[model samples]
Target: MADELKRRLVHSSGAGLVALYLLADYFELGLTWPRFQVLMVVLAVGTIGLEFLRLQVGLDWQIYDKLTRDYEQDQFAGYGYYMVSMTVAVLLFDPQIALPAMLMLAIGDPISGAVSDDSLKFVKGPKVLVTMFVVSAIIAAPFLFEYPLAVLAAALGATIADGIKVRIGDYIVDDNLTIPIYASLLAWVVIEFVPV
Candidate 1:
């Protein structure tokens, strides 16, 4: 339980990046969208490099033993997927879409993890699903208030990503990777195609 709490806390810290971006933008600190995208890409690349070392080079860090689940021992840890997914979101979507999508993973996923039990069920319970949706919607609301449909779609996407553990062979698609991508993609679809 302590380890899970620690993991969720670390997961939530990803929101700091979004906060930094917002502050930089609001205060005109010169962190433009392109600059932020570059930063995300660099961070993702670095994480991927670290993952390669951890997986292929057998560089086992002590922190991994504490934070990672048994399943992650032989697979890409969530952080790598998180960085890659976030980079993809930032590069592919506008700030209005990317920021909330990132928040869904940073804020919503942590909250869901806090409420979840130890069981690694493929599908989370109704309680956890509802909690994820609500948290995700609230996270999206400030950025996407003008587009209610987009907000709904983003929330639903985040909920689905967090609620269901999609398995691809032996590796479960971590919600850390899926949440932002799913939210951004669904929100983009609604914003681009649906006239609401």
Candidate 2:
């Protein structure tokens, strides 16, 4: 189990670091909505493709059997469904907000997962919640600084919604859902209320 967790942590962390670099570079190129959308489509497709390769090659399982053990067949299928849902949401909303929301999820969710897995001190529910909130807030800081309050509010709302979804047990709303929703809404609201 420990080995499996380590593998997952390493894989996810590497992915996140790469994503951060790409996103930072992309933003430096000029933070435009169209560019952000293109980036998201590429990322979404790439992640999906990687997951498919993992399943098809069976090499991922060999590295960590716990991947299969942790996710049931239906749960695995649900990942595809969730991805589709997120893609639709991004298409319908502003990618400026969506991008940051996605980043928050990308960064915050892993922090939560890592803490949950490794920290005996954070084993309690309150500790976990506080940790998640603090980590999420830090992730939100860049968005809040770059964008407006409305965008931040949207991101906050989305994060809360994701928390509710996870707690309710209807579906596992990963960072993908939480970050995008917040970012998108924040951008939308800011664009609506503020003048250019």
Find the candidate with the highest TM-score and give its number.
1
TM-score of 2: 0.57
Which regions of candidate 1 are displaced past 4 Å? none
- What digit string (tens of lDDT, one per residue) describes model 1 on residues 49-155? 98899999999999988878888898899889998999999999999999999989988998888888848788999999999999999999999998999999999
Per-residue lDDT over 49-152 for candidate 2, one digit per residue giving the tens place of the 0 to 100 score: 75677667543545335433355432343334335445545567654444445544545555655655443331235444555566655655665566546544
Instruction: Say which candidate scores most in lDDT.
Output: 1
lDDT of each: 0.92, 0.52
- RMSD (Cα, Å) for all candidates, in order, is 1.2, 5.6
* Runs with alpha carbons beyond 4 Å of true place in candidate 2: 1-4, 7-36, 46-69, 77-96, 115-124, 146-148, 151-155, 166-176, 190-196
Clashing pairs in model 2, backbone N/Cα/C closer than 3 A: 97-183, 97-184, 98-184, 101-179, 101-180, 102-179, 151-186, 155-182
* lDDT value for model 1: 0.92
